[model samples]
Target: MPRILIAILLSCALSWPGIAQAWGPLGHRLVARLAEPRLTPQARAEIDRLLAIEQASSLADIANWADDLRANDPDLGRRSARWHFINIGEHDCAYDVAHACPNGDCVVEAIRIQADILADRTRPDAERLQALKFVVHFVGDVHQPLHAGYARDRGGNTVQVNLHGKGTNLHSLWDSRLLASARLGEDAYEARLRLDPDPLPAGTDPYTPGAPAVWAEQSCRIALAPGVYPPRSRIDDDYLLQHRPTVERQVQLAGARLAELLNIVLATEVSR
Candidate 1:
């Protein structure tokens, strides 16, 4: 990883984490790192080509650009705030485009639109590169569960809790704390995830290329599951143990699917 990205990731982890969006920088980069080895030759080449425009070298290089928009480009950040997640927990963890995503503004729709832009060879590489960035980031976002969580609590951002003596919300805990609890650096953490001997939970297999809507619904269901809120709203090791596995699995799933998505969009010959 580059020093710049490492600085950004650490900065994100240290700051008021998850104050902006799902999965934070670590999760997004992990997803991209996991996707690297799975890319097809064409996809890799094209990705490299697109990234070269900004002097980037890997998917991880661009993974958190979407989240950094708040500081780097406020107008774009405001325009894309909703692209990080969707509210569907109250709607039975279902995919109702009209209700869950009005005016095609949510993460699900964002992924679809960005993918279209990326797949269009007619589009400028600069534009395609931005699309690639969004697709990488939003795909990871949709898998964070809370990103597709209930609207009532603003995806659990309002559901306060005490984590290791610090005050935060469930979303922030899941986004940064649980992962930070591992106390490993990015390289070591990725190694831990990569070397895990246990099989991934059944549905998280990345080979399954489901639509963004399906992905969001799956995440919403997880967010609404029991124990996620916990008794007395306290976040301790038990909560982390119970939920960190889900976070890891989602990261793995996001990485694999992100690779597949790029493979298709950057295939040797794409149709429009």
Candidate 2:
């Protein structure tokens, strides 16, 4: 009896670590940030519509349907809870952000996928809502710092580093660690973020595919920089201070553009 209990415990311990590492910090931060009221107007309307549907349906049903649909679309590629996973040798990390055939604006693709799934009025309300949530979650992911990072390094995956004595890759740490230490909930963080309201750069248009080029360029700045992993001692506070502007800016851009895209998606339907 004791041996059986020990074996079960060991199995769970091993599995738990793998599961924990999967989403990393960036994933969690994205999920957390989505709870804000900053979604694009279209996303806001869709979210309202989704909330109504969810109230009438089970989330589990929605999850299953999304999983099935994503599996059928090979072009959509991997459904990451965090970064946008691109095929490393096959796709150029820095191709023309617009008109980059097949894999260019993956962020746009994620939104469109959600839109198509939700457009199917016949889907169960529960399933439709789930699809909507996935859309919301995915758009947020594509905007993250390292999501659009380099391909040869798998977005810094090749650079190994230690996080407070724990062995993990640089990409993994950026995806999560850098943001987790912020210690601010959505409201507080968003409030602080709004302190210096800078409009999107002059001449920058969110609707154009050019939007992503802007974001990719931002990520590229930090892609190979030493900051991927700060010195072990600076891991907590200094890293946050150094990268806060970049981190905050990315989140801000993501929220604003998310609203912009959502507005575009729902305009035709909402107008009706």
Candidate 3:
């Protein structure tokens, strides 16, 4: 290969790793922050103990650990990158494990696996800590509508769009743009989301059997919802206005569900 061509290939290789994350840092931190206060006392203590292995102060501090690992740890990154999302068909909003995720390697399956590991007391603390990080991140990934979108577009990574005069792909737009467009800091965003009327009732458990599948399906439905996919790849204030509620709701749901999963898995002592 010519020197220039080799350089171009190397650049693409470096950039690809950066783009593999969902929700970006702010969104993941927001989810972790929201879930933090909701954890049961036992769950909180367990989380703190496990996280101390890395000398982290809070869930939010380590919320993006999985994404960071993708760039710094090549072997682990290659093995885990695909666990971030699953691809359903363009016309299909339902999740069929056999068809959509045949290998059981997608986000839904990742969540289930991590939850089990987190709940297994016999596992090493370091192993359970890694599971906790994934459970935090994948829960947020499942709530991002495009993460559960059609594979034809690589979850909209190929669908270019101009939002508010800035050029970007649909996946990046949902991953960070819309949330950033709100212009609210993380605390403000969390506070605003707290006011949403659709509360997770006091005793709700979001981790029932098949619940991860249900969550991914809901995201697929949102991706296919009217006005979500703009014609001609141009989005303006109207599009943002239309979808802001969905974004807010998804974040809220992710946070609440993450808390429920942690409470169940971490609060109770797991019998070997």
Candidate 4:
């Protein structure tokens, strides 16, 4: 695709109604913006090349493309919706492919597949662009503790609750509510997270042996943490105050890990 045309298509796609609304637009952009400056020069240049194919300005612009795929393209969405999350039993801390991610149909697996595609230079630009979007989105998804929560509740989607007097579900609450409660724009959110004096360590590689699984497991533990899943359906100020730090930390970790992954994959010299 011509670079200018690709850019136009992305602009249209981003504005379409019902774009995959993960992490709310704010959260995904925050992750992308945070990762932006941390990218290695090689990775930055490669990313620029890929974005030029679609005419995107930055990682944040394409961060939610996979979600948009889910909303606007039913066939692709149906096939990829499961790619956004993994469901583990509340009792299970371990992420076993057979029990939790049968046939590799989960976020952890999706990250692996997308990273491989993005890393392979021989792949067509269109394919790599799609993979790049998936990597950007899934990194944010895995950071959300509920995305790796109990299968019985559909990762807390089915658990109805009232947060700040508004009816919502546990999954949605984690996905957007807490972050939204801060009332910060995407830029502010990214700035605040970047200012964290203590950031979580990035993984050696996002696709390293057991890395995605470990990320999922870490989120699972957070989901199972006390008060995360309240006994009652109503969550108020106290709840938000308690878990806010965890949310901030997760975002920081995700951004750092994403930069680490992109740095490794995009820095590799893929032969034409």
lDDT values of the candidates? 0.83, 0.50, 0.82, 0.80
TM-score, candidate 3, is 0.91
lDDT of 2 by residue, 1-272 (tens): 69999999877543321112312434334433533354445655655666765463322223223223334652332333222432222243453534432543354454556656666666676666755656545445555555555555555565666656667666566656656667776457656766657445422545543454455545555554566545542254555578766666665666555555555544544442
- For candidate 1, the per-residue lDDT at 145 reads 89
Q: Which lDDT tens digits does candidate 4 get at residues 1-272?
A: 89999999977664332222447777888889888888888889888888999799899999877877755886887678778888775557688888888877889999999999999888899999889999999999988888888877677777888976788877777777788878887777777787777364555444473678889999889998888888899879888788877887888888888898888888775444
- Model 2 scores a C-alpha lDDT of 0.50
The model with the greater lDDT, 2 or 4, is: 4
Give the number of the best model, judged by TM-score. Answer: 3
The RMSD of every model to the true structure, in order and in angstroms, is 7.5, 7.5, 2.9, 8.6
Query: Which run of 10 residues does model 4 get worst, by summed lDDT?
Result: 13-22
Candidate 2 vs. true structure, TM-score: 0.62
When 1 and 2 are scored with lDDT, the better candidate is 1
Error of 4 at 52 (Å): 0.7
User: Per-residue lDDT of 102-140 in model 1, one digit per residue for the tens?
Assistant: 898899999999998998888888899999999999999
Worst 10 contiguous positions by lDDT, candidate 3: 12-21
Preferred candidate (lDDT higher): 3 or 4: 3
Order of the predicted models by lDDT, top scorer first: 1, 3, 4, 2
